[model samples]
Target: MSESALQSVIHTGDGRTLTRSEFLSLINTYNWFLKDQAQLHLTYSQQDRDGEVTVEGFLNISWGVTMPIRLQIQDDKQTPPSPLITPEISIPVSPLESKRGMTRWGEYSDLHQIDENAETPDIIISNVPPAPIPYETTTLRPMRHKNTEQEAESNLVRCQSDASLVKMRRKAKTAAQREEERQHRFSINGHFYNYKTSIFTPTHGASTKVRITSRMSTHQVIEQLLHKFKIENDPEEFALYCVHQSGEKRKLCNRDQPLWERILQGPSEDIMKVFLMDREEEEVSNDVAQYLNLELPILEQVLLKLREEESKEIQRVISKYHHQHRLLSNVLNCKVSPHIETSV
Candidate 1:
């Protein structure tokens, strides 16, 4: 397989590169053999590159009854658009043969085939018992009675049980055990649905992270969100809403219903988001523009009143300045006041 200089690099759909350890962990988790894995193996060789690679190979893993697999790699002058190409693997060239064959009776599977000819007579045996047929026991010798002082024993080649082993009935699980099983889905246990969730708050104009389960109800989700945001108000005062990409909003009203199920019934998360806001404030905030318009007349009246008061104050200030201006103009014209004639 031809590898580029950056063949070791692992790229994600989100345009992030993972470390080698992380990449190998993911590849192991996926059960797909990486090209690097082949290169790292002591038995790996360029000559063996003609074969298809299976995750089970050399690792002694087997999925089902199928032929052996050899790892193969392909090269390109330009880099592939996919990150998986580096592993350099392809499907099996030959079709797997794990299907049912022609029908046959399994009970007499080891018996020879019966003759199907006109010369052969069809014998019908009724209530008359047939002669006893002897068959060898699957043992070197027959076992003696165990009651003797030194009992002679003959162990069978294959241990045979007289009857099928009685299966033990499983104990019923308690309510707490069932609850624990529902809540925890560790990666190793395999149903990995743990999502890194962010709870957005329209009221606070911010967001906070809170771990919640898909089985949680709308009321429970709202309560958790309120606690995460440190909101002192009652949880009932707040409501959880899903906002669509087209600016459509849907409120989750059923307090007992599963919150995640309701969200999935609508649009996908990428096309919508969960937001927390006050129930009453959400309705009022929608009509805030109209409410402001209603207050415009009162605001205009207050402005007019203020303007009338400002005009009166301006008239008083202008009268005071006008007397000072007249006196200054007479002094500039060199006209003496008649009251100061005697002093001159």
Candidate 2:
């Protein structure tokens, strides 16, 4: 038969007709499926009957089950031939044959007995003589003498004294450095201010020039200013604003923030103007007040334009009402007047 005809034969188990390539492909797929479970070698051949095919193989399955498989495919014109796969009678496997190199249960003890029975040769040993001591090497004193003990004690005392001297020098140096740094002062706007001392001048307008440290918060600075100036305003009524060179002001929203953070938030200039404002009175800094004063003329111009637009809108509405009343009166006069007919 042709190669195509042979492949067209139906395969059983899965119920599908397959070409020669498909049949081989199916066998390859099963090869992978049974790879772990069995060892199979498949061979195909044409049977004596016409239109009959046979596939024979040997399968050695798991758990020592070995059998011969014979698959028969008979062609039936009415329907596709169904392949019949039959396995030969399985032969009983002998246990001894299967466990050729495997050790039995009692083999370990047998090995132990063989090892014990093997004899070891006898060994001879002679006695060793004692070594004689030289007369010149002998010493009258013991290994640890009084002089050596005294030397060790003196060395320990010297080490302890050196350690104490080093510790005292380190402490003195640290204290001197701390005192020098504490005495250092920073200059703001040509005025030198020391953090350790309160340098402030009180004024009547609830204004003051106070020295603020990195550790002081806005609230603490305000409190210090209030206490020094003797301003009786409530603590909550006061706020801090950083004035810019452009005359714009930014309110310090977080009063609990440290003065250092507030300074960082200001412009990059070394010295910046900061204002303490009374929220109730809305008292802004002099710079901010001047900036608002400059904007007064522009604000007045905007108000004037808005009023002119309002007057024009009112006049347009009044004119529209008068025109509508005139049209209605003309229509009433035409209907009420009588028409007089002259001679034709």
Candidate 3:
């Protein structure tokens, strides 16, 4: 908060009021005189201006513009306050004289130079004075302690830190638990198709595609599996063979539908056994071809390549066979299948 600045107003010598423009002109003149550092200036007396309120108080103030000083306007209706003191009109003074503490009066104490720094004297405290011994023995003072409120607050901080550590441990444990749960769902034979075809809800609208799955829907697939396994028999004989192999009772064998379904679902030991058996058969066939000193056909080579998982080269050969029809397809009779097929 600062002192309020009041505008210096003058009364016209006439009894009538002057217009606002006239009032502005007089104030401008007053401001210019102050800037010029004039020694004498006109006093804001009552008789100076017409219809203006008598000059009462004279204020020398400092303030910011945005936070302007609020003052009451004195119209012709009311008289203003009396002047307490006149302004000390600015006067020219030499720079040397000003430095030597010269004011309008005379030499004064050089108070302005108090802030100027001077070299400090060195200080040394060699030894501290001993604590005064009490004439009378006093009860041992309870060991000096921190304020109870402050001590309790520090304890609160420790408790909070402990809680934060516990929370972090719990969070880490929860993350580990989630990871374990995720890994548990994983199968060694797991691949993208299983995830894509699994029973999961879509994030959006009604699903267009539906998978109609059955445990043992078609006899053809069973026949194919048996053919791949070299079991040349009807479904009944196959079931019997499977029962004997599994060591299950005849009645228990009826669950072959589910057994086939689970086998097809993969990650199954039975499927792995079939694959391994096929590999062994292929190896035996290769050995027989070598012993006979007979070269394997191009299609057989392609099938072998495919079974060994050289899919990209197999596709390249297939495309080449299609382009050069007589050299490949006609000569070898290569049967085409869609992507993901292991056999020709």
Candidate 4:
């Protein structure tokens, strides 16, 4: 193999360079051996013009496989080049005996040939009963004794029964607590309103009377309003604000705080007016458009009602005008035709 061809194969695929020690270690670890008959031939006369020296050798591996290897070493003064090892012959080692002759069974039949003419003897025998066969039964012992197993099963059953009883008791207690909470009413004057659906009217015309518990937070009430009004915008864009009877507005900052805390801050007679407000101007505009889109059906119904009312009013006025015109025409006809009738 030429030096150029070996260099091409060495850097062809992963571009990996192996040193002399690493190359020898790989071959030795893989059980590859060099043949005693193979010899490494070196020609000192072919050294490069520079201080570089090239050594050529044949590496004999197992199964009579042989590969040509080349090493380029720099002079002691010059920096060494990256060492690379490349095999000239890439063909894998093949077995020595690839094919073997197979023998047929019939070819050896003559060695075990039977004497057919020597077996002509005749014999007669009376009928005999067959001997009875006996079977031995083997018993298997349980890993745990029967009593112990019964006791374990009973204990498991008792534990399961106790667990079920405890669960039932807990459920009953929770049910009783829930009933008590349902009966208990936290007295607070508050109204729930959504800004997205309400449009120009923030409170939706009039505030609603709501029954909320102390457990309910201002955040939860706002969430319920959003859900009730079917507001499609993000909940974070809206917040709860309290409007006092004194015409002062205060935004509810702590949403996680309980509703009772908010109720206690305001005047006693004045109802706590809580309404949803948009956090951002962009969100407000977008939500207003969305709300208008969602209220399209209701808007159409309202338009239909207004048109019906206008039509009814117009009909009533027309009927009144017709009644007055008929009276005027009757009076004119009676006065204008009286002379003619009298003359006739």
lDDT leader: 2
Please give the ranking of all candidate structures by TM-score, highest first, separated by commas: 2, 1, 4, 3
lDDT of each residue in 83-148, candidate 3, tens digit only: 243236434765434334424422212223222232222335578998896454336654454499
Error of 1 at 46 (Å): 47
lDDT of each: 0.41, 0.47, 0.34, 0.41
Models 1 onward score TM values of 0.23, 0.24, 0.14, 0.21
Provide the lDDT at 169 for model 2.
Answer: 49
Off by over 4 Å in 4: 1-205, 209-211, 254-258, 265-272, 280-344
Q: Residues 121-186, candidate 1, lDDT per residue (tens digit)?
A: 233557998889656564887854345433323322122221111111335654444665554322
The TM-score that candidate 4 achieves is 0.21
Ranking by lDDT: 2, 1, 4, 3
Off by over 4 Å in 1: 1-205, 256-270, 281-344
Report the lDDT tens digits of candidate 4 across residue range 218-305: 5665555444433344556655555444444455554343243332332122444555555432222332333354467887887799
